[model samples]
Target: MNYKTTKILWKTFVWIVLIIGTIITLVPLFWMLSTALKSNAEVMQFDMVWWPEDPKWSNFVEAFTTLPFGEWTMNTIFITVFTIIGTLLSCTVVAYGFARFNVRGNKTLFIILLSTMMLPSTVTMIPQFVIFRELDWINTFYPLIVPSFFGNATFIFLLRQFFMTIPTELEDAAKMDGLGTMGILGRIILPMTLPALTTVAIFQFNGAWNDFMGPLIYLSDPDDFTLALGINFFKGENNQVQWNYLMSASVISMLPSLLIFFFGQKYFIQGINLSSGIKG
Candidate 1:
């Protein structure tokens, strides 16, 4: 084939692949929405209706009303917000220290931090649970949010990688202007690393929002349950499940993450850039 024709054919092939991938990804979501909107009888029908035959939009409302969904959502939101804030603050400060400072044994300490990442949480879960119980933090939101303030090794490394790309000249200039380290970090580094920060926040938000095991293991009070736990409440004795309500709840649970990714996509792209470039 001629060069122009070959290129045209390749582009067409790429578009076809993308179109098929999009349909594959969206089909399940479409089915979930259709099932959520269908009446109980329609949902059980042997004949599939890709679109609901008799839409029962009230299922969304019923999903909320049939359980403590409102309370669970509020609890989840509260935990997610606090966890994101804590992770960002702690991760950024630690990353800044690692990227900018030359403290004694800093490398060794950082290696140790990285090592902790390799240690499976399951190995430490019992110990962690015992410690939290001793502190009376179990069954409280403290177990979920407070530890994030200490720092996460992976996020710290990500931010530090990004931070290392920043030009030292900017900081040197800031110092010449009589700005302290804190001032330079606060004004220059923090502002410039907004993309990495946003990325970290998004990750932390998703982690905190979808956490099921942590909440299940730590919290005993139904009042403190999160959406993930609340969804489990829909299951009953004899292995019976409310598939429709569960699917509806699942869709609702995913909305916040979807909304966040949609709005914060620019920052997410920026983070990918930082990850590929020099730390600043």
Candidate 2:
């Protein structure tokens, strides 16, 4: 084949692969939405339906009625918002200090922080639970929100990398204008690192929103349950599963994260690229 024709054929193959991959990724999401709109009979049928024959919009209403969805949603949102704020505040400050300071043992401290990420959470889970219980944090949101304010190793590492990419010239100029370390960070460095910060916020938000284990461990009251725990309970009742209602609740739970992503798609892409040191 001619070289031009060969190049075109290669591009076409790549495009085809990408399209297939996209479809594969999206199919499950579409299935979930479709199942949410189905009746119990439709959901249990031998053959699968891509779209519900008789769309049951009332599935959402029934799901909400069947569970303490309002309370769970409020609890989940509160925990998620606080955790995101804590993570952003703690991680960014620590990362900025690591990036800017040259004090003794700084490198070692940062190394130790990064090393903690390699240790599995299971190793610390029991000890952390004991500590929280001793401190009367169990059965409350404190255990979930408080520890995060101290900072996360992964988040610190991501922010630190992004902070390292910034020019020292800005900080120097800020100092020339009488800005102290904190002042420089606030006015000069942070504004310039919005993309990286937004990236960290997104990760923290998603983690808090979808957290199942932490809430399962720390929270006990049905009244205080988060959506993750509440949703799981929807299937565990009297050993019977309600597939249609379960799927409907799951779709409702996903809406906030989905909307956040769609609206912040541009900033999200920028943040990920910047954190990875990829320039477009």
lDDT of 2 by residue, 127-228 (tens): 999999999998999998998899999989888888888899988998999999999989988898888888788778888898999999999899999998
**Each prediction's whole-model lDDT (CA):** 0.90, 0.90
Per-residue lDDT tens digits of candidate 1, residues 1-280? 8999999999999999999999999999999888888777777789888887678777888899999899999999999999998998899999999999998999999999899999998998999999999998978999999999999999999999999999999999999999998899999999999999999998898899999999999999999999999899868888777767888898899999999999999998889777678334
TM-score of 1: 0.94
TM-score of every prediction relative to native: 0.94, 0.96
lDDT of 2 at 132: 96
What local lDDT does model 2 show for residue 262? 85
Error (Å) of candidate 1 at residue 260 is 0.9
Q: Worst 10-residue stretch by lDDT in candidate 1?
A: 271-280
Clashing pairs in 2: none
